[model samples]
Target: MALGGILEVVALFIPWVTFTLGSQTASVTFLDAFSKMTSGMDSFAAMYVRFLAFILIAGTLLSTLPWTLGALRTKRSAYWFSGIRRRELTPPNFWWYRTVFAGRATVMLLFHIAGIIAMFYEDLSKIGLGAYLLLLGGVLVIVGAAIGPKLTAAR
Candidate 1:
């Protein structure tokens, strides 16, 4: 469920980023940059880039779903029900917590990598919404990876 929430947030960010980018005036360099972005490139390249982005978005959500469902199973498991807490947690299980957390970590890692890639290839002058996304995503990944386990263990 945690993973799901994180992924859903990222998926939502996509159209938001696209709209922001679309609304902005393209610099002469923006046009020129694309012109020099591999001479043989076609609309197909744009399509492929979009497709890759879509896959990353979908993969984040898809990976998260099973972890969400597993939360329910964790609640029902006998091991989880026996004094795990005074009141049951939403997921109410240790393993489930770890699994969901690890899934979240996985998504964060993926996001971090993607952000680095975008940052590397990006024209600094054109850095805008995408740079913000990358920055935020990188921070989230670092925080999650560094602190998430401690939170889980405390529970």
Candidate 2:
């Protein structure tokens, strides 16, 4: 999850949109598109890509924290944060939480799917290196998330 999120974020720096006319070609990255927003130019696609960038970061944090922290505990333990206080935790180890990474990948909660959809719908011809990386990285994340749990349990 951490690696995937990092790659997704890095994808922002690579060329995602391309344009061509005659013998000339130009390309832009997510950051480039995003910066355009405050420069008197804004597009729905850029804003949506910006949102997906944030989701990737947040999702990485959520998934990594539990896995890293859970391993240090002597036994399964969780300290929940909520309004006021809770009398007790349902259990030390929660299975539902384990599904978060998988869910994010499967549904593409990080917004890679949306990015892909938006790209294909808006301008297929303009897709470039970064867009291809985004699609490939997204698929890797999904496959890794799906297999990671099973691999851990088997050993």
Off by over 4 Å in 1: 1-24, 27-48, 68-112, 115-122, 134-155
Model 2: runs farther than 4 Å from truth? 1-3, 38-46, 64-98, 149-155
- Candidate 1 residue-wise lDDT, 1-155, digit = tens: 34434543453333222223555844322223333466454544343343444455455445434443443245455234232343344533445454454555476556544643553454444444533553454345434433333224344
Please, what is the whole-model Cα lDDT of each candidate in the order they appear?
Answer: 0.42, 0.55
Candidate 2: the clashing residue pairs are: none
Best by lDDT: 2
lDDT of 2: 0.55
Q: After superposition on all CA atoms, what RMSD does each candidate show versus the true structure?
A: 9.5, 5.3
**Number of clashing residue pairs, candidate 1:** 0
Model 1, C-alpha of 30: deviation from truth (Å): 14
Model 1 scores a C-alpha lDDT of: 0.42
